[model samples]
Target: MHKPNQTKQATARGRGAGYNPDIRFDRVSRASFDDGWDMVEDLPVLRTQVREESAKTIISTNRSPDLSFDQSINPYRGCEHGCIYCFARPSHAFLGLSPGLDFETQLTVKPNAAMLLEKALRNPRYTPKTIAIGTNTDPYQPIEKTREIMREILGVLSDFNHPLAIVTKGTLIGRDIDLLAPMAAKGLLRVGISVTTLDPEVSRKLEPRVPNPAARLRVIRALSDAGIPVRVMISPVIPALTDHEVEAIVAAAKDAGAVAASSILLRLPREVAPLFRDWLATHYPDRAARIMNRVRELHGGKDYDPTFGKRMTGQGVWAELQHQRFKQASARYGLDRRLPPLRTDLFAVPPQAGDQMALF
Candidate 1:
């Protein structure tokens, strides 16, 4: 069992987690301290370090009842967006890394994701289903600009006519409109863009590196114009913090041409709990206690509840009210209608370069 240290580091500029928590699986723990001499001001800005990962497989499958799709692909191991409330942060711990600042600064990318995906799809016993992208970490995180791993994966999926659903907060998805638009026409693609808070200040402190609310709205509009079904995600609806913006966010997304809306209540599982608490202490001290209290209330006096059906929605009066608010807002904005599911029947492996021609 590992216990997190209570000491917090000064918030790094343009970064979300203020300090790195002890790796949950490590036998040793470490902490930072100042002795007489002060060098805090001389500390260097945290720079992102990326490593190339040679993945044997690209597609991941899960049997969680809370998820809509079982098959998913995560092109990257860690997200660079640095969203403080991100539920995927804890995944970094499995790599023997902290789920705090390391979750954002240290990233591992799958350069051969497209090749592996193609290989997987070409397997004789494989079955076609909707493969979800960005469910664990944002595939279009900042590094994707140069890595283009997500783009390559998208290209392979399009070539195979594979059905896919993407969830992201990155604005770079707009760059792939050419591929996405054609796939949308074939009922092969849909996207969900998360807009946590409309307030730019809150967004800056909360998400840090993601595009602002307006830019994400524009992404929804652009995708919608391309005939791609867009869903606005009001994810991790923080109780005392961004919860007040639920209706406003839904309305704004609807105006931006989002065909549907969905939300996930804030989750503080594992190492994420302390990191988020530190974030709240640093940014919103006045409301931090109130926010955490509400979160605990929803989770039945705990930081989080991992129960299959209840994890995504939460429980208690506040959770019920939050659900009602989102339900009514979605209904009012005409975002209650669900988008048509991606078609798996269109999936077919295209001929390769040296393949023999088929008989007529």
Candidate 2:
């Protein structure tokens, strides 16, 4: 890991904002200080490393009531889109890594994901259902351009005629228009594009390395123009910071041809809480305390509450006000009225060469 000097730390806003040592491993944490001296400084540049993971199974099943899908596939373990408030950051702790910088700089790629998915679909007991992608991390994150792992997974799904849903903040998904457009036509695919804020500066500091706000809107337009159903996700509606942009984001997505919309209140579960608080202090020091105070109110005077029902959208006045705003905006924009459901009937196991033909 590269260490930033005082000057670099002051100027480098997003790249190393939440860079912290692994608390689980380090007994003592060190901080750097600069003494006025004539010495050359080397600016720190974080490099990404991909460690291939050998996964036996690709499909992950969960019974969480708040979720829309029952199963999902994650092609990668860590995300390059360093969203400070991402709730998925804690997952990196299980791998003995820091949830701060390690969650963004160090990543694991499951190179055999496509093959494993094909094998899972071939199981006789496997049932057809909408398998979600990008639930844990964006499948189309920066490395996807070079790895092309996500593209291969989509190709496998297309071959097996598998129905799947995707939620991503990456613009790279636009590259797969040929695959997504056809699957959407067959009612096998639906996409949710997450737009945090329309403010370019806010997006840059909050979700470092993600596509710009304008670029994300362009993604919505492109996907929709290709005849793929697009849903705009205004997720993790940070109370005081970005809550005001609710209506504006909804209108923009609707104008771009997105048919539906959804949102989630900011969830600061575990390690993400401190990381997000640090981000608030760095970017918006003036309102950091007020923002966190409101967040606590939403989570019942705690940093977070994992209760499923109240998790996505919190409880009480603030939560209700946010929900009502979204409801009114969506209604005014004619979003989320009657979007088509992803079809599971189209799913079928690809026939092997030795497969016997059924007699009619």
Candidate 3:
């Protein structure tokens, strides 16, 4: 007989912030355990990952007002950092996988990513535009250390003088100091480090495998000191949870050398909603209801509203309050303004080998 869908309503957020992911379906229940998940994984277990490739050399562009860039590239899918509240978790649904463990354990690495990018860049119709990385999945996540896929992509971008932006939570980026520093000198790059909370307990439970808040601040300092523009992203300002640190986090990043700063409210999209709910019920049972209640209030009295204009910043009293706090604190720290724009004028496509027809 086929196994039943045994894990109904997985939770994604308790150990983290609002990005927690858990799987749930029909007629499934979890095993009753006396101790919590923290007790269950005392010893480190080797994580599993799946690698794959796509046929395309390049991905097309779509317009989104919230995001700055039109085109993007992801060398890997499914981050291994295992942050429970990762919004990218639901992307696993496309492959008929659960957003819980499947998202962290089953990953895809594209070995030919740099080759394909170079090919696309050399295309006649290709125009140099800022290609966003680390938008969907972190390029510098744990697996990067071994795979080095992101490093290869950066090499290609540097060769062609392409403008790029990265958002990350790992310290692995420090390894790319050589590439990023020169790009920064040319005003061709920017980096954003997401700092969710200052409290260690909160950081451990929420982001689990990612770097600590202090470590992330060091990233800001290191990147900024190297001349790269650093933005402190106080992301997903979790109400009744992480919202308290909005000002303090900003203050810390500014003092550390960050030249700019921004914040985004928590977003619970599709499979993410149920997973986050399950996490709340499992971990913070007492405040679960209140947290969801506040999320709805910020999201216009609903779990989530997909309205394009309202998605990034949400709405209502709580959202407005979070925005106000960020605005005031950022202004005070001289981080209210946007960083200088990157230069795309340096981009150039080199000729392929034996294209003697051009010389003739």
Candidate 4:
């Protein structure tokens, strides 16, 4: 039997600027008029909860043809960045948690990630491939400053001369330029910074906790100055919203020292669809329906398309137009360049207790 649906009221402090419900769970929140609604207007502050996750393995392999890399590692399960349109949000439902506020408030960290990575790299049968980081969640999220799990994992990768790529919107990634710069010099690393919109107000409501667009651009410049390759990702381009800023974003990144640029059409999978809809309703009520309507037009009349090829770029007129815009922007801004691929041949396992020394 299905459980009874439960509802909770969202308070100013606990709810994001564009708060919404997680579609996976039966529990939801709504304004109650019985007590004049003011009774629930102000609630206690919501604190973040961090949990320890002892994962059996560190390396995760995926066969998705659309992905650039085959293996990846997520030091944290839930992101505190709190991007309302995060595609990774739906994955939180598998943990029996709400993909709404719970996803941002509750988090899990794998403290042993460095050791596990080292162990995996030591495997005799293991073959080297560029390991992707921050694919599911930002490795440099706020908590990383205290947890330092991402730093530890980077240490392991640096020691093994492992090739890796990172994608993030966190400014904290600058703290690890010491690790990344050297790896990049050896053709073993590349970084992608995701920037959604240039408007700080829009960013505040959309990806509330992430760094502002200007700060993200500074990160690209800093990384590029250190001889590290930077790829500006104008990601999850909302059709009726920030879509107009595509060329401007690419041009800005190019001016900021980004070597290359790319983009992904916004994806609203499963629980994310309703959550995103609610977000649009809260923040852009006037254009909410029109935006989703355009999204459906791109996704074959559905909220999203999970098919590999069409999922990233979508189909039809609008998608083609966006594709053409990106191509033109890249060409116009000289942003159509490729960074050297991360090198895998330099991988070497450090000597263990019983290992014999190599002859000089």
Better of 1 and 4 by TM-score: 1
Best by lDDT: 1
Model 2 ranges off by over 4 Å:
1-16, 21-43, 353-360
**Candidate 1 on 104-178: residue-level lDDT in tens?**
989999889999999999999999999999999998899999989899999999999999999999999999999
Better of 1 and 4 by lDDT: 1
Query: Which regions of candidate 1 deviate over 4 angstroms?
Result: 1-11, 38-41
Residue lDDT tens for model 2, 43-70: 6666777899999999999899999889
Off by over 4 Å in 4: 1-42, 352-360
On TM-score, the candidate that comes out on top is 1
| 1-360: candidate 4 lDDT, tens digit per residue | 111121243442434423434445546534323444445344555668999998999999999999988999999988888888899988887887777777888899999999899999999999999999999999999999999999999999999999999999999999999999999999999999999999999998888789889999999999999998899999999999999999999989988899899989988888778778877877899999999999998999999999989998899999999999999999898888776677989998878788888899
- Residue 270 miss distance in model 3 (angstroms): 1.2
For model 3, the superposed segments whose C-alpha errors exceed 4 Å read: 1-46, 351-360
Instruction: List clash counts for every candidate, in order.
Output: 0, 0, 17, 0
TM-score of 4: 0.92
Clash-forming residue pairs, model 2: none
